[model samples]
Target: MKPVVQLLYFGYHQAMSCIFPVAIFGTLALTRIWEVPFLHRYDAILLILLAVQYLMYSSGLETWDEIKVICLFHVIGLALELYKVHMGSWSYPEPGVSKLFGVPLYSGFMYASVASFMCQVWRRLRMDMTGWPGGMASFALGGAIYFNFFTHHFIPDFRWWLTALVFVVFRKTWIIYRVRATTYRMPLSVAFVIVGFFIWAAENIATFLGAWTYPDQREAWRMVGVSKISSWFLLVIISVIIVAQLKHVKAARRAEPG
Candidate 1:
């Protein structure tokens, strides 16, 4: 295939893989512009996402296993949101029946959307990995990264240290993905940064759409700081590791004797 054709194919698959995220963003933009008569924006978003999920499943755009993964991330994300809101890292600041301790239930769908993208892209791009860290190392790193999101608030921030460890641990890891008949590989760390950067960009858009607000944005909206890329970078690592481990487990189970 020609280089231009391959690029187009790659872009097409990527867009297809972003169905869930796109839906969430579209809902955010729409709700920001138009108020629901009888429903709060957050509650409306939750309902819309639930309907979207059903549609995706009914249409065979998502598998049962993928849905399970997305559900897990939703819970994980909600837990983080609860803690973050308590700690004043950010606030929903929106009134809704779905609000729990000042955090909206619809917020979990944001994180679930990331998992949805990972699962979809993994399948669409025929993704594989080389030199994946062992389960112990990967899970431990993921755990540490997650805890740091909370611990950093109370103790000295260790994000940079964890960031360093990520590079060291994934030094030999590479992601293999296909575009049409051709396969391409990139360092896993580079992939993490790429995904994180895009997520940060999306975060800016989400904030602008009043999906949520940072402390600084209480009075007016502003771009999220570039430093947030590191946070999202770590978050992307955790999301990727979880999805990868789940895929690995499924593969291993399939390889077992029936």
Candidate 2:
């Protein structure tokens, strides 16, 4: 396909991905729309990341505080990705990135902004960060999983400096156990740790076995299929921990405390 044709195709594909939800919302606006949920009405935990605006409006969480956090996460994520792509850390499926940062400016904003909102919805529905003890364990475990999916071997040459992160973060977090976990806590933590380790190992093995290899992977770390999965894993885990520590949105109450 020609470059122009590819751009057109991407635009159309992105449109379709975005259109269905808007269409549903439009229909609801016309109809009685009785399904307006209070807060996290359904288990859209990850799904909410897609239907952001609809949930924001319907969930009655258009407050400034919520909006600020959503905006912050979006901006940060977009900036981080854009920087990474520009620095040759990764590239998108489409060359549309450079149109703004080589992609389209507003286009990037639209998607990133929407994702930020979804994070808020997640926090609100997760019961507002209540009793989150064993949190660091999962974050330590899950985050490594996340980074591996995209850039398993793309670590910086100087990153060996960060090698001491494990001992440092672990010791600090262990000492500052301000919060606590409930019944579901241990299981959730275990899930992320196991998943992170498994995926990290798989990525490494695949590379060795010639499955998926990181082409621009750092020369220092690229093994046939072996690389230290610790950084990405720890990075992910720490990120999750930070997010867990953040405030969650509360379901609105019918009776005003006043």
User: Could you report the Cα RMSD, in angstroms, for every candidate shown?
Assistant: 0.8, 16.1
State the weakest 10-residue window (summed lDDT) of model 2.
175-184
**lDDT (Cα, tens digit) per residue for candidate 2, span 1-258:** 456765564445444433322433343233223333442211222233345645654666455554554455445456655665566654433222224463223223333343342344333333233334544554554444444434534753433333344434444232111111311223333333443465465445433432222445433336433354544344334444544454321233424475
Model 1 regions lying over 4 Å from their true place: none
Q: Please state the error at residue 211 of candidate 1 in Å.
A: 0.7
TM for every model, in the order presented, reads 0.98, 0.38
Top of the candidates by TM-score: 1
> Please, what's the RMSD in Å of model 2?
16.1
Q: Which residue pairs in model 1 clash with each other?
A: none
